[model samples]
Target: MARLADYFIVVGYDHEKPGSGEGLGKIIQRFPQKDWDDTPFPQGIELFCQPGGWQLSRERKQPTFFVVVLTDIDSDRHYCSCLTFYEAEINLQGTKKEEIEGEAKVSGLIQPAEVFAPKSLVLVSRLYYPEIFRACLGLIYTVYVDSLNVSLESLIANLCACLVPAAGGSQKLFSLGAGDRQLIQTPLHDSLPITGTSVALLFQQLGMSFLPFSMSSCRSL
Candidate 1:
């Protein structure tokens, strides 16, 4: 298995795949846009698939691009924040006889109090990219008789496990196992501060490892 840093590097490249570009383009095209009234919140965020070794600060580097819009569902209210939807697709290549599509939706609701406001609601919608990618890959692998249900299940389980807090002990966090098998024992001290290395190490301590899901072949739409 590769280290977490390696995974990031590889995944970064995977974002450059041709199919990845198409997927991101589709996402941007499907994004819902709305007019903004001078607010602190970002109106939208864009995605780009740059070439390997591309520098972010380089002048006129023309990287591949995709954009997402965050719009207020209720524009009449001044305090209501916008909701965000992330979209992307994965294409598995192989000789599989049939196409298999697995769709999963996970939603997180955050109370307005959590954001230090009165009655506000925040909803986060996420799609499991790696799981979806792996499933497609497994479908391709099946074409060669190299796929196993157990392996695919393990991959999905691991991908889901990745969503859990990366801490040793915390009552607020979800625990995957009982007793010695418990992976997270605490709440992550710094949720956003936590690095991919820290996450990979946490998983390593729990007897699991990760491999890079390369997206180098993906292109920008």
Candidate 2:
């Protein structure tokens, strides 16, 4: 449920503060990232069951949900995500636990790569781990695994820093072949006789390059 956003790009800075006023601080002076204790559950969000109707049945772990909030150092800006976990199980006769305990087995599914993320969570949560997303994310944090001690801001900042490229890096590869074309050139290999009117006369015959007959002399032409 994380957008993996980095707030540093939007944070306060030094030069902006000095120019504003006599006693004011930099406009972009500090970052927005924080740890969980310092950042509280963003207060007063109403939660309800999924609309229209709801049904509950799980072969394994209980359904879990959380609301996360990310904020800046000054608490000026905020972002949030809703995260939920689910189990994935299928009723298959051959795939039962006893049949595959010591045997080599393989399973396959036909779907797009986009579906793998969601399906993977279901697959793991249904059979092996009940809390697949939280469990996997827990391995990432060396301290306080699954305690949710990390603030939404810090989580977003770190995730974005890992996945997103910096602003100017994207254009580097595309510009490598630039300047290969000759925009303004004179032919050093050719011999040419030039007169001011002679150059104009040549393309005029071709008709594509020259727009003749001025409006000032329209009737005469």
Candidate 3:
């Protein structure tokens, strides 16, 4: 049960330079920034769970979930990314509070940064490695940016519009199957600007799923 088009596309870089919150605190100290009481698995990016719920298991059908991209050199030249979610709520109480009688409990909440974006700053100096999104999953991660200027078809059309496809125009892409196997590759030549209107106000502060990728392909993966 691996939806969200499956998931996979985590590039990295940022050996130090880039300031203003120090490139999102070094991309959250190399992907390990899970807040909200930690439980939502998926360290760096790409998270869309629902199958068996609870970080689903059974030899992992689809697991990886974490996406943090940072490059905020101070202000407008923004470049930040963070996505994490694991939410469930249903808590009610009233066992004689005022003479009535109540009991309804079901609580669970782990919404890390949720989601945040602000690409541009020329796509993080034409992003080349940024850190390969921390690798793992079929492994092939790559990264190597050293003064890159920009223009590899506008950095592959802004990373093919941040690839999140799967319905029809297939393009795999998912993560969280366990780390270090090696296959995720990285290497670009260029690329944004209000950091793209604060990346739509950081995807509305993280309740993402703008769904696109040609309507998320159509489903099934």
Estimate every model's Cα lDDT from 0 to 1. 0.25, 0.27, 0.27
| Candidate 3 local lDDT, 124-200, one digit each (tens) | 22222233333321122111123334333333333323433212222334333222232222211112110212244
TM-score of each prediction = 0.19, 0.18, 0.19
Name the regions of candidate 1 deviating beyond 4 angstroms.
1-50, 53-154, 161-163, 166-188, 191-221
Instruction: Give the alpha carbon lDDT tens digit for every residue of 137-209 in model 2.
Output: 3332322224645453454334333221222112111110212121111111122211112344444566634
- Say which prediction, candidate 1 or candidate 3, comes out ahead on TM-score: 3
RMSD of each: 22.8, 23.6, 20.5
TM-score of 1: 0.19
Give me the overall lDDT of model 3.
Answer: 0.27
Give lDDT tens digits, candidate 1, residues 1-221: 11110010011112343442222211222111332233322222222222122222212222122222234455522211112212222333322343335664333433221111011011111221232233323332342244333453343233333444334323222221211122222223333232223344444577554434212211100
Could you tell me which 10 consecutive residues in candidate 3 have the lowest summed lDDT? 187-196
Worst 10 residues of 2 by lDDT: 115-124
